[model samples]
Target: MKFQLDQPQGGNSISRHDGQHVWVNGRQHGASLLVPWRGEVQDWALARFDDLSEAHFEQILALKPELVIFGSGAKLRFARPALYRALIAARIGLETMDLGAACRTYNVLASEGRSVLAALLIEAA
Candidate 1:
């Protein structure tokens, strides 16, 4: 599926997504990546959900977003709460979903100018 903004959006918005990849503002990316509500896109360096660690969640702390959307590849998976304790302590809300749903949700929250962060994991082929 694809998402389009009726008018121009300031930051990057997910344009399309599927089982294998997600297109950010029309640019195709197959690797895990992070899309902030505002800022440059960056590689996430995660191949699967099991590869997640507390350090990974710590990296997100620097971005300072009010919310986080974690996309667990093609299937819906939940991460251990301990891995994201920093977010909880910092009062940052987190929502977990499949990759496609995360992409769609990111677009909606971002368009509304919310401080949303999307940590999407695209499975390796």
Candidate 2:
């Protein structure tokens, strides 16, 4: 499947794929596992916090997603133990990766049949 995202002013449009890839202005952005999902792509603004502890929880609360993909910049990091526990409590699945990887994962999951939401912090490339 292919999606056409509107380009922001002075920015390029992002073409998302059902597989593990995203195209920005016709260039592949990243590589990742192709996990298809059934949901909408939710965008949120985040601030600097000690890890993605609250951000994950808040996004889950707001989006009510079956699964959440966190795009934590350019490197993969496990969510804080507290956050993981919270997710478990809420019965929400959580996956963390770098921004690009998260984007790919989001597209994959969205393509499949899982209800997915993404909280990303990546610069446009």
Candidate 3:
């Protein structure tokens, strides 16, 4: 689906998303990725939800976002809390949702200037 929102100045916002891809700031990305409110969008090495590990969350922790919106591909699934223990220890909030919802929610929070990261898992189509 495509989104039309008044983007916050100088910030990145999700412009579109579907099962196989997402568009950030008008650029299309075909793989799983990390979308921070600002800064370059990063290709997350996660190819499937079942492959998630603490190391993945640790990578996100390094980015230091106040909150993370984890998109579990086309379905709403929660990760093992133990996998993200480091994030909890650091006082960062984590929310899980299906891909589409994550994209929308990330845009809303990002537009509000919140330090949010969208850790989306875009599985192969």
Candidate 4:
């Protein structure tokens, strides 16, 4: 039962991932999403990196994660500070990287018992 107890709750291992989808605990998500260390997985409505707005970052505040890993689609992209001012003010940690890297790092951190959230944006294949 170790495998079953690995994750603290329903949000366990990310079973699989690809260019267009992510599977958490065997559940497939075809769009960008917010994977937290615990609790529910949220569907992040970011269609593309360029479409990211201040509102999107602000919306993340409601999740109240201690750290946020930003997955900028398949390519690596950075966000402007102005777009994430709320996160700064909240003293939340932020890390930016390509989608693949974000997903991997999120897995490690989450398993280690950290409160991390991965915000992944995937484009059409």
Worst 10 residues of 4 by lDDT: 1-10
Query: Which candidate comes out best when scored by lDDT?
Result: 3
| lDDT tens per residue, model 4, 84-122 | 999999999999998888888888888878888888888
Say which prediction, candidate 1 or candidate 2, comes out ahead on TM-score. 1
User: Can you tell me which runs of candidate 2 are displaced by over 4 Å?
Assistant: 1-43, 49-56, 123-125
TM for every model, in the order presented, reads 0.92, 0.57, 0.94, 0.90
Q: What is the Cα-based lDDT of residue 34 in candidate 2? A: 22
Better of 2 and 4 by lDDT: 4
> What TM-score does model 2 achieve against the real structure?
0.57
The runs of at least 3 residues in candidate 3 whose Cα sits more than 4 Å from the true structure, single-residue gaps closed, are: 1-5
Sort by lDDT, best first: 3, 1, 4, 2
- Clash number for model 4? 0
TM-score of 3: 0.94
Worst 10 residues of 1 by lDDT: 1-10
Candidate 3 residue lDDT tens string, 1-125:
76765888889989899789999989999999999888989989999999999999999999999999999999999999999999999999999999999999999999889999999999997
Against the hidden true structure, what lDDT does model 1 obtain?
A: 0.89
lDDT of each: 0.89, 0.55, 0.94, 0.85
Off by over 4 Å in 4: 1-10
User: What are the per-residue Cα lDDT tens digits for candidate 1 across 100-123?
Assistant: 899999988888899999999998
